[model samples]
Target chain A: MRRLNQLCCALGLFALSAMAYAGPPVEGALEKQATNWHAIIMFCIFVALSMGITYWASSRTKSTSDFYTAGGGITGMQNGLAIAGDYMSAATLLGLTALVYGQGFDGYLYMLSFFAGWPIILFMMAERLRNLGRFTFADITSFRLDQGSVRTMAAISSLTVVCFYLIAQMVGAGQLIKLLFGLDYNIAIVGVGILMMVYVTFGGMVATTWVQIIKACMLLTGGTLAMLLAFSQFGFSFHTLMEKATAVHKLGIKLMTPGSLLADPVNAISLGLGLMFGTAGLPHILMRFFTVGDAKEARKSVLYASGIVAYFFNVIFLMGLCAILVVGTNPDFFEGGTIGGKLIGGGNMVAMHLAKAVGGDMLLGFMAAVAFATILAVVSGLALAGASAISHDLYARVIKKGKATEAAEIRVSRIATIGLGIVAILLGIAFEKQNVAFMVGLAFGVAAAGNFPVLIMSMYWKGLTTRGAIVGGYGGLLSSVAFVVLSKAVWVDVLGNKAAIFPYSQPALFAMPIAFLLIYIFSKSDSSARAKAEIEAFEDQYVRAQTGFGASTASSH
Target chain B: MSSAMYERMRGNPKFQELVATRGRFAWTLSIIVLVLFYGFVMAVAFIPGTLGQPVSEGAMLTVGVAVELFLFIFFWALSALYVKRANGKFDALTAEVIKQAQKGGK
Candidate 1:
């Protein structure tokens, strides 16, 4: 039971973390290719299964509580699997493998950075978040502060992050489908948009969570099958795998250690900090904490999720190494029958090529379907999160001022989900040719600098005031955006400038401090009656956060 | 929660103990993760060659891969350790604290 429970959870987070590294360099190389009928057939089976789950889920989603958090009745084991699904992505499998296939150990280092964020969330933030939050993270952010001001800030920041991330995924889904499944780019974008909307609008959190869980299982199975098959050829020897991989690879022995990818100390540390705190601030991931029954379940889910993330990182790492030996030397997998030539669909197709090499057409078809399913699952999670930020935070709390009925709030969220879906489809097509890889990085930056600082301060600090949170939140948001704009990723790489104005590609190291400083200085100086009451209210918030007293309970209905 | 319930919980000794113990444990584990992770990051940034070297003479596995493998298992073990303690001891204390506070409220 323990192993089964943990297995489901592990598969989920591994999928979510994969999305972070779908880099521009890999996604840019996608060219329209021949439709693999096997891939398309397998993909249809996956779609049918998920839609069936959605049909089952729509019946249980009745109230606002059901819509946002599955009535908070989900077990830790299932929550772990569902939430983990939100983390793993097509980009993670394809991008990380490409990293290993090309640069070797730096790929492992990149995966390590992504995995580092999970533990901190598990240890420090999980219980408090589960105890204090209800439908959205805004509930916690605005728990003590003036709801009108703080919720608005959280909603804006969340929507900004969601929009950027949605566009990136949508564009990624379009290109990846066109390349791997032989579908038209527009058709793929519209397909993803429609599916996400249907799942979120009808199934709500229950459907979205189950979709993630099923996707996690499929991805885990396909990846493990491919990894095991590839490893068997090496006589089940890690030494032989590394030896043969390095011998054939151009990087040779250089792939064994960290190289110039993150050779600069400043960028390495900054990128580390960005990924760590940025994950905690993500609206979608944070929403998962509230899915389980209580703080106890929250802790259990974290334990399982972290274990899965770390374990899957190793799986992806081994798969990358194995690909070097199996796919690297074979001229048939490359363009123009050249061993070192551009991979047929792009470098991101290394894992797919590796799949075909090891397990033949059947396994290749299964992996291709898993990759497509991965995108849809992630998009649904993001859409639900965005919808909650709108209907729960912006609409119900801000406009209705806590007077809105449950039915009205759920109605608003369904409409908002559709609204977000339409905008995502439009933006996906609009940015079809552009490199939107920076969008994911920018999403992390906003989460770290904008949402993370204030959320942490509110949970742990007693002196946080509404004025301080607003100023600090906006300051962090603006500064992080400004820094990313001037940084090398955008300033030089995207904008085609001579040099970057901001030296570091990551803005978190610098932006996080400015946010904390502003919040501290502003909060300390506030002498208003409202500030005094907010400070005193911290006592009850502390009690609730620690003991789950008076917190949202599992819905009986 | 009402102010009276808040006051009752604040005065409850078990509540105080749970807070102190859980707070300390969480931060301690957090610091451990921070130190270990940043240490790896620093090594990767500054001393790539040391990790590039083999674990021993003529060994195929690099120092980097071995250490990474260790960190992988060790970090997850830390998480399990945390859940084991929190779900057992701290949760029991928390339940007791809430019960006592509710009695005082009635």
Candidate 2:
């Protein structure tokens, strides 16, 4: 039956990708162009470098700890860069800039909410997570709670977030490869899946971290260069750039205001809640804490990540503005020479088009390669996190009752990575036309609702029992997914329903509170001996969390 | 590893001071950030028209854009502040408390 199910999934995915390829060519300036050799070469170089890193990492990865945490040898600064790289995917650069090109002030608001998440993570979760966790986030939640149940719940939640996030990245990668390399959607998705699998299965966290670090540096450099070129056009004056942007944009001066994309207050607040808190709950991001040696390094990592991410966002905001003036008004970027016509490869190509306008084909190729690298790096991180949850949390701890050998665990992790990579590719092809940015938001909502509530309660609330955490965690997970399904974004937009049952698209605003309430009520009413024991153990957990007294140390490989 | 060591650390004046000071500092900064961020959200919700208004006569920039920029800088500053204190005073106090606990054990 399981083999049949796997075959069915494979056939379904093939059918989906075939359908997407058979569909009419996307309209606008991006009409079926020849593959850019320059971009392909640059991309090949990047892939070769990353594969070399993977080979090196595989040799060093001998134990479960090494596979999971890179032997906890990463420095604070390097981890910070990797975190920023993991967080600032190509969707952030391209999708966000496109939003700005199309909506102006609304895009800026999104950028702000995204950056706000980092500070909250630094303030609340980073240090404690580093102190408590060893491999996956389950290690932290299972600290004072029932190890079996808590690990199961955490594994489920982690997989949910990872799958959602993975699909979003994969979809973006497909679209990007299609645009840049002129590759078919199916082939692009498969290529990305295969490369990401190789990275995670062979290299594990060490390869993943270095990939992210390299990608982050490339992305930062590309963004900075693009911004500089844009600035040169206006003599490096913000005033002149804004003036030109206002002139070029249809909305004129009003483009600088906040009411363009999000006019509704409730929706805006809900979106804010999702972006801010959802970032804190991300499993892959939390899993990064284990790569560092100590709590201090973890804390420093968040600080550095916040700074680098903030700087990147600010640069992209300006880049997006410059794109409005440069790419939006350029006839070369429009189909049929129509003013305000559909851009090539849609709005997500705005950053790429801007690269072309400012620096021509060579820079455009460089930026495109960097963008592809960005996707590969992020997907590898997500794949690793998901695999760890499956192998470390569920298979090893829950199924084997913590008796699984190190080699067995590592083997399982690699197998899980391959499985996850395939699933992500299929889902990516399936969700190709959906807005990748909004999908990322949905992933955040799920993370915030499901994982964040259980994690926070387990850490701070002594009364939280294993049963309470499970109930709350799953409650958040189900409610978030349900609300999103009922929302206009999914029902009306994606599923073609006439109307949506849920008023808001983002579910975190409602689902998070419900999850918290369930945990509180269940914990308060519980009088079980197990609950009492867990509550009593909270003192020790608190001490360890605060002081890192008995925290896991890095092993010498 | 022992309950006695935990009890000793919890009772120590320096440990108590570290916990109280750090907790209060984190909360204060967090509340400030929440207010600033949520306040901006509220403004965008309730008084969006005001946010749409330009910062100066004939200026292209709006009040909303300017304030968002300021909030971004403020957040970075707050992070730096927290990290500074954490690495300096917090680390010092933590090391001192751990040393005293280990000394007691010896």
Candidate 3:
């Protein structure tokens, strides 16, 4: 409590003094001097509040179940809020919106793919996932199997997904703080890193969930108010806003139509599949299902989540249009839209730039703060999920021989969270200058490649042996990473040098199918793979643990 | 009633009426929700975007986001209906079926 007071006082002093001392840098130096202090202060408040929640939750947690799954006591509504929080990451909040502002209909394709996944998650995965995996995504994949290789592959995939996701979010945090608070990029990265570590280390999933819930509400409120104000700019008429947006389109700058940006059918379709199925395949997202109590309740949570997400994306779509229309009207919005514009980039500043055009420093500061809060909340979840994969699946199972007590596991988890946080901070600092939009795409691609195939096979195919899962999961992981490294997006767009290495940017077309085929082939190879003996033993341990039934009953299968 | 008639309507008269009424309500509620949500989007697209006037872009985004923000409440309403109907109607029928199944009755 004393620390909290000191932190608040320090922030207040910093905000007042920083604004008085800060001066706008010249065009080239703008990135250095544009840190929005208001945003920084707002972001700190959320981080501090989340830490408070984590401490409270940690105190209440008394057992292994409470530590790992929050005793599965979360109400459906709370889970729904967390689900909203989980889905609306920096990628969806900033990347997609920025893409829409610049590219028009092409950007909507991203939202369409993301939004399309919820119904699929509800209908296909959620209920069964809860029924099968009690604590982690690994539970379902390692079922009735040796779990050694499968757990390793899952850990690798989980780490990769979280790393890329953290990079995107952390970079966004740094950029948002720099833009809104006048802080140095390095300081912003360090600040965000420390906050995320504090939240996950002290609180675990409980702290993580509440922060997500609060951020989700703030995001909804911010997004709605922005859209409403955008409409009011045109007298609350959708037609007028469309007319303004369309007129801007007529100036040979198409922001509302699809073909204007994509230009190729293959790229468009692949990008679409990547976004849609990719959301369901995310380890962080799949982990949220375990936090809920029952299989039946899991179904209810997803139903609500889908509806919320579907509507949320629709509003974001309007905000995207508003970005171009309002910014289109005020040339000042994009004094830097191009080579000579005030802002150098087209994507990151769409939300902030639009807010400035509509309101002023206050609105800009508030939106920027919300964006920062979004990044902090998301990175904390990613770090926590990754920590669980390490401490629970690998450390507890392998090193401790599964005899590690709950207290021991929690200790390991906290240590792992701190380690991951340090890595995230370093990566955020390293990649802060690169285009953040690509980071999101890379995260999705990696997840789709590594984890999705392994998960799908494990749940549906009873014949999927441990060997098949290990090979398929690892194979997907390596192939996707290799493909991404060679792809044009990385070589030419990111590295700014071009040579024909990998013909395709998107590898899901080749990699995902190969992953599925490998799993199928391996699952069918050995007669012993279908051994009824092992199935009975495996069922005795994990399946019954989930059903809340006597563990011994399943031993007879 | 004869055993055949009792089997057709179930052993309990109250259970039959509840199923008929709740089933209708469930279907109607689902359809209404589907239409309302889809209608909201269609209207947003055709009704003139909320983007062009004197309002702040943040406010516009907020309003647009709010439209979807209420999904939690919608879900709460759906869950309430489910619990109410399940407790009021579905559970009773389930109990009757269990009793019949246990008795080895048709």
Candidate 4:
């Protein structure tokens, strides 16, 4: 049955490629094209290897600890790669590539700021986070505050970020599968969804982490090689290439030029804040810190991760530039031979189209495969984080009062993983047609607003009371979500309808400040009792985590 | 006071050194990366192209690709260097610290 399914998929992909070639060529593009069997085969091999790795990791996981954190045995280097894998999702690869391809230097700014976030994560938050939490972000934030309120707020924060971010990933999955395997959109969504569930459900954090590591290595390698090939095409003269690219595509070149590219200052600032502060608060990214053996290891992992992530984004920026230059000359690059039709009118499709143009069928196929794997790896991580919040934080901690056995907790997490996968699939399908880049930005904004304040206070500030943390976390999450929903980007671009709910499109200016205020005010109000309890807990956890002794005081749901 | 000093020195000299080495490396790396990254951005903004070159559009494109590839290799080398340090020296010291910090039986 599986072989037969594969055969049908192959035939369908051929038909779609043929159809795309038959269409009118996009402007200033090449017409020559061929079916890229090498790219397709390469993609399949990567997916197979990832699945095998997940299976191996899952088979060894028998208890909750093994499933959720691989018994915290992952080496610093491995964790670093995994962290890189987790953060550099399809959005960063394909979408950013397209943005550079279409827009120019402005795209490079996003890459710079995005990469800048890593140093901030490594220098500021990583060690502290490892010292404070176990599996979920809540483990740290709830230490000084009310467990119930913190968990509730954490759940909301996790759910909000996952739901919003999942939209982009799922949509990317659908588009990628359709483009690569020629599968129907609905079928592709369900297939990708089911595969992610299988990955996280059986393997848990162990599987997710390994998959992430493998994907990151492949993405970095693929991106590096692509950039090399691209530079060679230009004879290593960046000046000449830029001039030629500018001369060929004036609008694109202008966008690449600094100072006048961004459409709005508010949008740029909003995005900057989202990338800068959001790295510390993302639950999936934070969970990777716990899998390292100790606080020191956690710090090392982030350092390695920053290096890997920095290089990868730099390569991706060049890749984006290459894609624009190459695709600009090839009229038949995109489906139906029209840039807008092929590109979905956004920056995301630029990388794949450019790959097809520069490297022909083989590189294009490989690029598509990498993009697809990126979606799968990220969706799996998000699903796992969301499930952990539900099973460990909500069910085991709140309902059972930490009485749930390891076996039972693992089972609950598995079930939640499956459920979350389904939810992601549904959201992906619903928002598949929209320009959903802002969904990722929305996730970042919410995380920064809702989770960062509470987490920072719980770790460093003893006066943070339970009420204060809860109020701060939940308040941040709610206001961000509300602001995002009402933003012009959400209403006009996503919903395809215009509404004037807020004058500004971005909400961080208001939401983030408000979150900080709430936590500060509440912490001060109940400073006396909260201070004593939190100081004791913080020191205890810090010593335990630093020395690598005792069970992690940071409880898992 | 003597025990505290002894503990600090003995517990993990390698680990402590690793931490300090990384700390310094991080500062150096950030400055270098920022300079390179933002330097390129600023140069592109401020610098003018030396027009009238003989290279074809395609040839020029190939050259650009090579430079980008070289940058990637530089990054890979940077990471491999860190790993080598961690594995050869840092890990060795960390293992020693773990052994010394072991309970009475050891």
Number of the top DockQ candidate: 1
Candidate 2 per-residue lDDT over residues A420-507, each given as its tens digit: 9889988998888776555676689889999999987887788899888988999999999999889887888888899999987688
TM-scores for every candidate against the unseen true structure: 0.95, 0.94, 0.78, 0.79
Q: Stretches of candidate 4 above 4 Å error?
A: A1-40, A252-256, A259-266, A334-347, A494-499, A527-532, A535-557, B1-106
**lDDT, candidate 4, at A489:** 76
Docking class of 1: medium
Candidate 1 iRMSD, 1 decimal? 1.0
DockQ of each: 0.79, 0.66, 0.05, 0.10
Q: Which candidate is the best by lDDT?
A: 1
Each candidate's clash count: 14, 1, 51, 32
lDDT of 1 by residue, A95-177 (tens): 89888888888998888889888878988899999999998998998999999989999999999889988998999999888
Model 1, DockQ value?
0.79
TM-score, prediction 3: 0.78
Residue-level lDDT for A153 in candidate 2: 89
Cα RMSD for candidate 2?
Answer: 4.6
Q: Grade the docking of candidate 2.
A: medium
Over the stretch A1-557, how does candidate 3's per-residue lDDT look in tens digits?
73474356446544643553265532453553265555555655765576568668766665555656677777667888888888887667777777777665556645655665565455446645776776678877876677666777788788888888888888878776665566667777877787787777766777788888888888888888888887688897765676567666542323343333334445545565566557777878888888776655676677667667767777777788787777755656544444225443345677767776676666776677678778878888899889989988898876676899988998888899989999999999999678766667677877787788888666555567776777788777778777777887787778777683877667665667777877777766745734454444443333222232221111110
In angstroms, how far off is A304's CA in candidate 4? 2.0
- Candidate 2 structure quality by residue, lDDT tens digits, B1-106: 5777777787779888987888888888888888899889888777877888889987777899999999999998999899889888898889899889888877
Cα lDDT over the full model 4: 0.69
Worst 10 residues of 1 chain A by lDDT: A16-25
For candidate 4, write residues A1-557 as lDDT tens digits. 63354345445544554465344433322222223456557766876676667667766788777787887888888998988899898878877787777666556666666766565565446656776678888887775556776787797788888888788788877766665555556777877787787678767788888888888888887787778888788887677667677676657334344434433556556655667678788888888888987766786787788788767777777777666667766656545666435543234567766666567677777777787778889988888889989988998888888899988898899888888888888888888778786787688889888888778777656566776777788788888888887877786776767675866766776788888888888767764765557655554444333334443633232
